[model samples]
Target: MTPLFIFLVLLTSQVLGGLNNGASSKNVGGRRQPTGGGGLDENIPVIEIRGEGAPMSSAQIRHLEEMDNGGPLDIKIEKTFVPAKCPQQAKRLDFVTFHYKVFTEDNKKVYQTYGTGPVTIQLGTGMIMPGLDKGLKGMCAEELRKVRVPYRMSRKSKSKVWKNIPNDENWLIFNIEMVEIKPYTPEIQFKFLDLNEDEQLTNKEVQDFQKKMKKEFGKTWKNEDIDNVTAAGYYIKYFDVNGDGIVTEVEWLKIMDRDEKLINDKKTKEKGRKRDPGIGWILDFDNDGIVSYKENDEAADRFDAGPTLLPMESKDEL
Candidate 1:
């Protein structure tokens, strides 16, 4: 019980306490062990603990890389083939014809235009998905590309689907080959129609154009052929905004602009609606948007009544 004994005891107790503290602070698996109170060490960094599951697939890995690059949901373009000379690359509002095969993330083919005819659509128009519209902007004829469209940029939900094309909350892959590009403008169309170079389209010229189109299409015309030929047939009746018999360049351009605006306005108003009536709704003779049972019956009767050639004056009066 002397002073020397008490000092030795105190030193031994202090040494034991230091050893325990050192053991508690030892690193385990590169992370600092928790202190004695069972709380995480403030110096230890946070670690994400993922549960065991199937290993990440290649597609998932690529998606992660995309996210790291800050473009996970952005459209991805991989040029498979680039022609040495791209004289005419597609631009906004240009008429482009292309063949494409659409696939899901697992490479399951959803839709395609291979055996069938290539699709022709005006770029920057909402005729196709937004991702595709932007992806095809700079493509040249014969050029091939692989485009990855994230779900966010594509049509989602069944209501937004178009033409029964597969549209779900998943990434869509497209293998596209540009077939042709045609510069389209109202002036170009008008010039082509005014073959005599008089800058005015007469009824005979319009009829001739329609005949030429019928010959060119050659018995392959479907009900959905809404092209220049159809427009020409209706020009004298509907597009000649004035009572003039011939359509001048100014009149043609003005009417064309007005019609385009009307079509665009209709599309905007019916953006999310199912069943766009298109031009076929004219059969809804009662002026109602929907085709009623009575209207269908009348149409059937007209079909059964045989084709009768009504006088042009009578037709105009009707």
Candidate 2:
């Protein structure tokens, strides 16, 4: 071949090689390979390879296997009825008024809230079983459902066994009907107590609110004729930071924040304090800054009997 012809042949070969290289560079192991710069290509989608890093130790593998086998099972829900006009649904931390009947796997009734009344509980508050709490989510008013609660999701205590509920590993079945859903928060509760839309909570307003809640929840005060002034003063004393008879929204929020901080601090500072004292303080229904022996006893009884889903009660009764 002539020298010019040889040069043309070499140039053609180089051009073909460059095209092949470009095609190969476009893809690597099913992922789009970045080009030119040592930076990810924003236009190309990146693929993630799970378990592609360091090999897990034998102990780690065993622990993961154990978790897979022993972790809580998801609650099974079977909807019985769903209303057409479902404007609202129960969600986490929302107050749900529900009527429930708990039964064993064998269909033996364990507990129920039919004859007495529907009970209200704040979802995700540890007031009910994890299964029940999760099952109640997304429930619209007047909706009926059958929930199967696994044994792992039920309440367990080494020191106490709930009455009628078997301590042995057994699942529960709940037939539930959602009555109402109230969106709840500390601010909402404060607004509820304010009552007058005056941006402040008065002692009388507090008293009236408590009375209204008691009646609404179908609970009676132990002392029917309990002194209203004294009862109201107790809550005012705890919430009213400026020694004023009325509690402003800011003051109420501040007290709540302080209580939360105190609880968190105690939890971090003291490892031995297993139970949150904030809950205990809340049990001081009289708001006297001390949980009385009677209060403790009542709480213990409630625990043994299974909580009634009533979040709060006066020191007098629930």
Candidate 3:
């Protein structure tokens, strides 16, 4: 061919080659292929259940697995499911009080946390399944989300320690609703301090609380070693002003109230409130003199310690 004609032909071939290359490069490796079905978008996942019978056989779970990008966890959120109201945002290390249910692909309910009071879990902690722990991030109080915990993530659930789950179940589907955010408040601290739930915080209770606190929060004045002057002893020595062995509910509240006052004072530092006396303040619940358990429990809900472990119960409670 002539030079000009040859150049024209070469240019056309190069244009067609570039178009083909663009189409090939549109999807690199690791990207998911479209899921196929009628009335269902190819992009959305649909788990087809092939079987011999009716409901049991033809059942299919809408995977909504767009987020399942080969990651250990996959999350599907339904914002419209909940009421218009949504609570504050949840972040890492924040104690979140939430309810959850687990279901098998057959739509059979396996587990639930509703019967027991809402469960509290610290976000980002490995104590929960890896998929769920990560999925719960950025959620707000009352928001609803679905998380699929794969077998790799479900291994922990199969253990004896996680008695709530069925050992045989391979995959776990979670329906999580953020009930409330459990802020580390004085009442919460008090409830944790009142280990026995007797309303009164004894020396033993204080010791246990301090020990747990030291382990979870930070080291004590003496560090790891158990000293003669223990953390509990210091609290008893400081708060048990009358030298009574038992710290009554009134006394418990007194410490908590002091904390509240101190918090308030710090907020308005320049405005200057009266300096709080350590234990000189008054608290007599029964008028008979000592603080009774009944009196102590009157305000227990605000600070009563929740179960550290998952409560074994059904979802109907919520």
Q: List TM-scores for all candidates, in order.
A: 0.44, 0.44, 0.38
Judge candidate 2 against the unseen true structure and give its global Cα lDDT, from 0 to 1.
0.60
lDDT of 3: 0.49
Task: Give Cα-based local distance difference scores for all models.
Answer: 0.59, 0.60, 0.49
Candidate 2 vs 3: which has more lDDT: 2
* Residue 218 error, candidate 2, Å: 19
* Cα lDDT, model 3, residue 151: 51
Q: Give all candidate RMSDs, comma-separated.
A: 15.8, 20.5, 18.9
User: How would you order the candidates by TM-score, starting with the best?
Assistant: 1, 2, 3
Candidate 1: residue pairs that collide: none
Q: Point out where model 3 deviates above 4 Å.
A: 1-83, 114-117, 124-127, 155-162, 167-169, 197-203, 206-318
Q: lDDT order of candidates, best first?
A: 2, 1, 3
For every model shown, the clashing-pair count is: 0, 0, 0
TM-score of 1: 0.44
